[model samples]
Target: MRISLICIGKTDESYLNMGIEKYVNRLKHYVNFTLTIIPDIKNTKNLTQEQQKSKEAEQLLKQINATDTVVLLDERGSIFKSIDFAKYLDKKMISSTQHLVFIIGGPYGFDNSMYDRAQSKLSLSSMTFSHQMIRLFFIEQLYRAYTILRGEPYHHE
Candidate 1:
């Protein structure tokens, strides 16, 4: 199955970009993986939080196909152990999932419409993380999941 990570806005920090790139490259060895960055909304200073999220949702939804299984990276979503995440991915692949799209929303989070479009929600951790930092964290966890699936030494119990 082809896996994609669609997130709003560019990761500004060079270090975070570097880390994200590292895992992204590693991921290419295991699956068809793509990172699509939606441009941030301009002049957010004037828009209300809900308005900003609505605009971001429009951009995000445009990237998704009708056949794609969308998963939102939400704080209130289901949490999983690293090994369990690997198993979950394995099931998707085995079930012939065409495209699995995971989305990271904007700073204020996703709009109601985005939630409606998603098939599931996944939480990386209970603690809040900056959107920029979550990019690196999520990518690294994805890489670790693959390694665990392959029984590689990259992940430790």
Candidate 2:
């Protein structure tokens, strides 16, 4: 299965980009993975929180295909260990999922429509992190999950 991470906006930090790129390259050894960034919304000073989310949601929706299994990265979503997450990916592969799309919403979070469209939700941690920082964190966890699955030394119990 092809795994895609869709996030709203880019990470400006060079250090974070390097870290994220490292895992992205490593992920190729395990599965088909891609990180796609949806450009940030324009002029938000006047828009309400809900309006901003709605605008961002429109961009997010555009990246999705009807066949893709939409998963949201939400703090309130299900939490899993590295092994479990690897198994989760394995199951999706075994089930012949064409494309598994994981989305990281904008600063204001996802809109109700996006929530309704999602097949599942996953949480990296209980504590909140910046949307920019979450990109690196998710990529690292994804790499760790694959390493654990392959019985590599990168992950610990």
lDDT leader: 1
lDDT of 2 by residue, 46-143 (tens): 89999999999998998999889999999989999888999998898889999999999999899998998899999999999999899999999988
Off by over 4 Å in 2: none
lDDT of 1 by residue, 1-157 (tens): 9999999999999999999999999999998999999999999999999999999999999999999999999999999999999999999999999999999999999999999999999999999999999889988998999999999999999
Query: Which numbered prediction scores highest in TM-score against the true structure?
Result: 1
**What's model 2's lDDT at 135?**
92
Per-model TM-score on C-alpha atoms: 0.98, 0.97
lDDT score, candidate 2, position 56: 92
Candidate 2 C-alpha error for residue 4, in Å: 0.4
Model 2, residue 128: distance off in Å is 0.5
